[model samples]
Target: MVNATQVSFFTLSAYFDTGVFKYLYFIIIVSLYIVIICANLLLIVVICMNRSLHEPMYLFLVSLFVNELYGSTGLFPFLLVQILSDIHTVSAPFCFLQIYCVFAYAAIQFHNLSILSYDRYLAICYPLQYNTRMTSNKVSVLIALIWLFPFLAIAVLISLSVPLQLCGNIINTIYCDNYSIVKLACSDTRVNNIYGLIYTCLIVFGPLSLILYTYMKILKVCFSGSKQTRQKAVRTCTPHLASLINFSFGCLFQILQSRFDMSSVPMMLRNILSLYFLTCQPIFNPLMYGLQMSKIRSLCKSIIFGKTLTDA
Candidate 1:
């Protein structure tokens, strides 16, 4: 009979273990994280200060920014420290925390994007009813649900993970992930895997389907109007569409990666791609949605130059 010790030890050698590339990757990722933080922070400030942006749409945007900020901070800072340090080992408790944080953020992001889609759906489909349906009270409730629902799910999952025994110390990817962490467990992980897959499908695919359906209905509504109205509607939806596409693809890829076995894939290649997806979205989100918007651009410019003008 084979005991736990009889099981083969899985060694996770560092990919991009070289000094130059490691530092380069560190600097670039850190720089991107800083930009994401600043951009999102500025967006919240501008939205709050400018009464013009006090609508439900901008309120949702601000909530998304805040969520992204917390999400990126949870993973990137620890990864940055690891990249710089000689020691790369993460303890069990810390590892669990990492998994909890990643899942919590991912769930919140999915739910928030879904709410945004529903917002668009109402605005386009119901038109006259949007203002009444998406009131401040309703929006506040939705936002609260987006944050709270994920926490409950994560708490249950982490509790399940607590009893599992870990055999290894090294996590192959830059940051701790559910799959990688489960692979360390001494017991059978089939239950965890099954639950994870089910959760991923519901959290990722379910929202993705809703977004697609909402957009399709929105398009139908847009095209029913005059050519100019159709054009304007498309223009308005373009930025959200870009973000939806990026987010959907990123999330789907992550879910696929999590569900399938990745032993055949080169660890370095996996690390690089994972880092790209994880960091790039937060950086790109603000650029695509907030910075590119005419109102946000004007607000940023005004804030920067207004003080100087006043002083002079």
Candidate 2:
């Protein structure tokens, strides 16, 4: 093997214990990835084809579904190959690409959720104006912005990272991430660190705060109104709430993993927790929403089994 002085490839140290059963693990991982891809694509197609679902709520959902595919594609294909291989090394450019994709995925997830919450707020609190307010053109612009903001923000973040001089190239995680890559830099990464914190606040916590305020307003209006209104609010918001909680847990895992000392945590458990955001949220969001939302659920049933079932 021809050798160079600086690190050109990063050997992922997280897969150290995957010995004889790597093939079995590989199969399982590939199966899950396929499932996430199929589910997201199906829902996206359904939303797009049905004119009834072309409204702001479903449009936002379709955007999210697309992002799920975007995020999963970044990790799963590469991950499947790594699971079956002996040497788990990633080239430099590929690592940075993964960094961009994963960060953008997570950032956009929060933005999408925040947008959905805002839609619900307007719908429930000011139903008569919802149609006027959330026009098709306006929704289109919002959707474009939702995708573009993260793409640009993370692009800047990745560009800043591009100039870093690395002291090492071994990442201690199964997947490549911005912070993980930054930790290997030879020079002081305080700028990157500060930027990351600010970026996290802008993307994750900022959106979360807005969502909370929206929910509080929704709750206020629901409680002040009739029983029917309360029920309607609950029906529409429950699935969103479920998704928010699930995604929050995944985000929490990522934040904790990056910040805290996970040495005492079992390796298998750590791997699972680290993977939760990427592995679980993609499948969970659409599944939970599709089943809970009557229109999408019935549409799915009608298309799948040739007849829609009557609501009991």
Candidate 3:
């Protein structure tokens, strides 16, 4: 039996022989990575350069855009290499690193969205006190915690998996996963399993609960307020809602595909579904927010065109 320390590499069993199509696959992935980097970078730059956008909402958006870059960078380059290589194997340490990046990315995304919902809640429900509540210092602290908590949590997770005595090292999926590694362990995994459940609740359910509560409060204010207030609520909340829903579905698809028996599903569809959250969400968020938010849209136009177009 190969133990964890003895295992030097893991073969990704999901990748098949694509023959000549491998080059085509490589080109498509490269294009996607370039787009993800450029779009997210543009948004981050736009938010940081404009003083009018130094408020809590745009600051949170900067964090969001930065994460899109972080998450995509972690996956895309590795994926591009794998697509072109005949042997789909990764070094053990690199595999663990990828797991850390993927898990931390997910945790940060949920926390960021939750913080955004709360920001919107304050802005719409208590416009008079929104500034007082979501001050610059507070926003900085929240963004810090948003990133710090996830890194620490996923650190603990990776630590638990790193020292295990592994019976096998072949991960059935295209990328390394903590649970997949845990399942390969020859040692006891009760603690790992238990901690994973707690981590899941903290990373997933906890933020979702906060998001739900904030939206409910926002909805109450919208119902009782004036037409102008209602319009404001709709205009501001629409992008956030769309982003939350889009990311939530992507996560849902990924989780279901990972945990459930997906053998009946076609290989191409399974591969696409597994990669949906990582690939699509990075691109989806910037486009969704960029076009829908008038301020961002106008600023992007000004930057790209050298003059602001009239807001229609």
- Give the top-scoring candidate (TM-score): 3
Per-residue error (Å), model 2, residue 247: 0.9
- For residue 133, what is the lDDT in candidate 1? 97
Q: Rank the candidates by lDDT, best first.
A: 3, 2, 1
lDDT for model 2, please: 0.87
- Candidate 1 regions with alpha-carbon error over 4 angstroms: 1-16, 261-267, 307-312
- List model 1 lDDT by residue over 1-312, tens digit each: 223333333333454466778788788878988898998898888888888888887888888889888888888888788777765766656767877888888888888888888887887778789899999899999999889988887887777666666776565666667676576788787778787777767777777788888888888887787787676566557777777677667766665666687778877666666665567777777787765578777777777677421211
- Weakest lDDT window of 10 consecutive positions for candidate 1: 1-10
Candidate 3: which pairs clash? none
Between candidates 1 and 2, name the one with more favorable TM-score. 2
Q: Give all candidates' CA lDDT scores.
A: 0.75, 0.87, 0.90
Top lDDT: which candidate number?
3
Tens digits of per-residue lDDT, candidate 3, 239-265, equal 888888888888897788777788899
- lDDT of candidate model 3 versus the reference: 0.90
Each model's total of backbone clashes: 0, 0, 0
Each model's RMSD to truth, in Å? 3.9, 3.0, 2.1
Rank candidates, TM-score, best first: 3, 2, 1
Ten residues in sequence with the least summed lDDT for candidate 2:
1-10
